[model samples]
Target chain A: MILEASDISFSYGSHQVLEDVNLQLKPGMTAIIGPNAAGKSTLLKCLSGMLRPKGKVRLEGITLTTLKQEQLTRQISFLPQEFNTTAVLTVYETVLLGRVHQLGWRVSDVDTRIVNQLMQEMKLTDIADRYLNELSGGQRQLVAIAQSLAREPSVLLLDEPTSNLDLRRQYEVCTLIRRLTDSRGISTALAVHDLNLASRYADWVYVIQNGKLRCGGEPQSVLTETLIAEVYGVEARVTIGQETRPVITVLGPVPVASSDFQSERDAGNDV
Target chain B: MQGTTANDLNQAYERLGRRRLAVVVTVVMLVLVSLFLDVITGPAALSLPEVLTALFQPGSVSEATQTIVCTFRLPTALMAVFVGASLGIAGAEMQTILNNPLASPYTLGVSAAASFGAALALVLGSGMLAWTTTVFVPVSAFVCAMFCSLSIFAIGRIRGASTETIIVGGVALHFIFSSGVAFLQYMASEDTLAAIVFWIFGTLQGANWQKLAIIAVVMAVTTGLLMSRVWQLTALRLGESHARSLGINTERLRLQTLILVSILTATAVCFTGAIGFIGLLAPHLARILVGEDQRYFIPLSALSGAFLVSVAALITKLLIPGTIFPIGIATAAIGAPCFAALALWKRRSYW
Candidate 1:
């Protein structure tokens, strides 16, 4: 199924967070790259039906607003940027809870099978009994992702999913999500801060700048030195190596910040 | 070597579920045992055989013994069970929605509102209603408790029903009602002051068949409603944002559960005159024994609460032999130290 958001605009009171943002997600890995508070998270929220934008979001040719919450949630799963819990819930139980809409007095066999299979596939079986609070940040992130997949959603959306991870864990998580997207034939979209990570893993890339879609295409075409310097307000060099993925090396922030760059910097600080 | 198989994983999870079930069953048995002890060990000092005969076969026992067992003690014993169960469920859901370990019916001013209502009745009698003092006190308390609860709900609704709004509103209401009670006490005559003090001390002495039935019916119906949303409640422990992303409609859930908890608490405390700490203590103990899977957590909370108050009732009878101690005072005197000890002893964090 294709997840489409068209001419979507959203604001927090009078301050607009997103304006005329249009995007589409097919069955592959799509990364939304932007600086802080650039409406990446807000747009993802709009597509997942967590927020009501002015324009319409449709999945498989049907409008999102027409569907009930339970049905909408069953098709699209969302993982927010910050989700940490100290409550004493175990890993297996947390994963099973991904099927919260379908859960009954007795857990069904199909739900059990899905959770068990996902745990094994994610290599989370060893720590299935460990409490969520006891796990490291990276492990918890992996468990959160596993829980999201347990919903069997056709579209999966994540916001800053690797914000707290180490370099190695970030690469591993991105790789796993990419593999799952291809294997399961589900459209996966991630809002990320790292340009190189998006270049390495994402099949399609969309750059959001100041609540609007700046540019989108294959990473090699969309991620350029001029584009990076313009959108991110930093001097950077982009090179396509033998691996065919663009690599970005940052120089520094723009020497003389423009008025627009300064305002975007201020908005980024609000987050 | 092969990694763990699906069969082994399933077995491990099922084993954990079984263990939690066992804990719940154990608490249920302890509650029943406490109920029996409460009935048998009152001031009348009947023998075990005599108490059993009076309870099951009243014809064989003497009329006085039967009256003592069935008429005088039975209602109070049963009241403790139902009231404790009601408070337990209320506290468990309150903690979940408020996202605070210390939250309870008392934290939301339900008990204090009830107290002020009782003080109004005891100090000034019923001015508007023609009912006797016997009916006036409880009715006034229930109305006042509901009033406090609804006002908090209204304030929360206006402010988007955030946790902070509800808690702040409840705290403000608590202080207002507490001062109202104090003012009433200051203006009362000696006899009325004594009556107010006695009611605040919270005795189960006023328990009757009608009050017991009302609490039982309300508790059963509310519990059934809560049980239907066990998955949603458990999802709440994951944090509000996550639950909302999963389409739980968290604001609506919080409001709906708050209403149910208010009704449960008002009914339970209005009859018993503000029984203390059972609502606050039971859910924490249940969380320690069983984690936040509401399937186990809710039932275990109710059972543990029923067990604690039932035991408190028994201690009230046995503490001074002939003199019945005020149940609220006994509950605090016993429960506080026990809860403290449990907190210190448990290596795992119960919160």
Candidate 2:
């Protein structure tokens, strides 16, 4: 399936967040790497049909807007930056919610099997009966990933899936994500802040700078030192490490350009 | 090691499942017992045989005893069950839609609007409806309360059905309608004020078979509709955006649940004034006992609510020797403390 977005624009009230954003993807891992407020999350929301944008999102050549909410969900599953549930449901019950679209009033055997398989695959078998409140941040995120995958989506969109995790958990989550996406042949889009992780896992990378798609392609080609410096306003070194992953080391914050800031402010008036 | 872990989990799940089932069944039994106790232990001195005879074989009992059981105890006892179950369902639905533990039909000004409607009818209703104030008051209360909630939900749609929006809208509507009732009280004649005050106190004193039948019909139809959407509702517990991502149209779900909640709450409160606490506490208590799965959670919530109101009525009867204290006040006294304890008690995430 081909997931494509074209000429998409979004604004929250008068503040325009994304403009004329375009992207295309096949079945592979894609990372939307950007600084804070660079419309990475907004673009994902647009593609997921959470927020309607100006143009069109085509999922496998069908206009996403034309599909009903139920029809669209079968093909696409989005995991937001933070999805919290304070209800006292067990981990098994929480993941079972992923099959909500399939279940009737009672939980079917097929549903139970799928939930059990996903929990086991995610290493959540031990905590299956534990309350969601009892889990740590990383564990909760794993549960949420299991939930998103429960629907068996062809396309998965995640917004900052590893932002809250420690170094090891981050690697583990990214590795799990890569393994799942690869095994399932699912096209996955992740909005990530960690550039090295993105370069490591994301087969394709889109570098967004200030709500615009600055550039995109292969990670090594797109995540250059100049692009990182310009987009994040940070001095950094980009190098190929032991493997093929682009390793980024930040030096210091770059001084702000008053002219650039003023011109951006003036551009905001056009919205 | 894996075998032991899986076995332990399976055992734990089974134990918890059995425990929840036991608690729910016990509560249902308690509600049934409370119904009988409520009928038999009234001010009228009816022994077990007399009360049973009045209940089963009216011809065997005296007319006065028959009248006492049929007219007073039966209707009031059943009203608690009907109203309790309805508000419990309403509270569970509201909490899911608003995503707030404290959310309920009463807390969201639904019952207050019903009271205001009843107050308006009492203060200003004329000859056209005077012959059947019973029907008129409830009909108008249902309409006005539905209108109030529909408007709240419409406003909520604009704001995305977040907790703050719903709660703030509820607080605003609550103040408006409650102040409306208070203002009507200030202007009402002695008879009118007394009637309105009595209605607002939320008693089962006025329950008749007819009112019970009407509430029962609405409760059955609405609850059936809600039961069909249990899976969707369970998904809603994961927050609105997540539910939406899972193919659940959260906005439509919120609107549907809100309207149903309004109807249930209005019908329940119109007959019995604005009874509080049951809607707020029942769902929380049910969640504490039986996790957040709506299939069991909703029914348990309904039963818990019925149990609370029925117990409240019995407490009201027992408080004094002869005169029956209003069940609504007794509920506040009884329920508020229980809610406080539940709130203060260190459980895993009350909200």
lDDT of all predictions, in order shown?
0.87, 0.85
Q: Write the per-residue lDDT of candidate 2 for residues B134-226, one digit (tens) a residue.
A: 777887788878888887887787844467787889878989999999999999888888888888888898899999998999989988998
lDDT of 1: 0.87
Number of the predicted model whose TM-score against the real structure is largest: 1
Question: What is candidate 1's fraction of native contacts?
Answer: 0.70
Model 2 ranges with Cα > 4 A deviation: A257-271, B1-15, B126-132, B159-161
Which run of 10 residues does model 1 chain A get worst, by summed lDDT? A255-264
Worst 10 residues of 2 chain A by lDDT: A256-265
Q: Can you write out model 2's per-residue Cα lDDT over A168-191, one digit (the tens) per residue?
A: 988988898899899999999999
Deviation (Å) of B260 in candidate 2: 0.6
lDDT by residue for model 1 over B1-79, one digit each (tens)?
A: 2235676778889999999999998999999899988888888768999999998898998999988888889999999
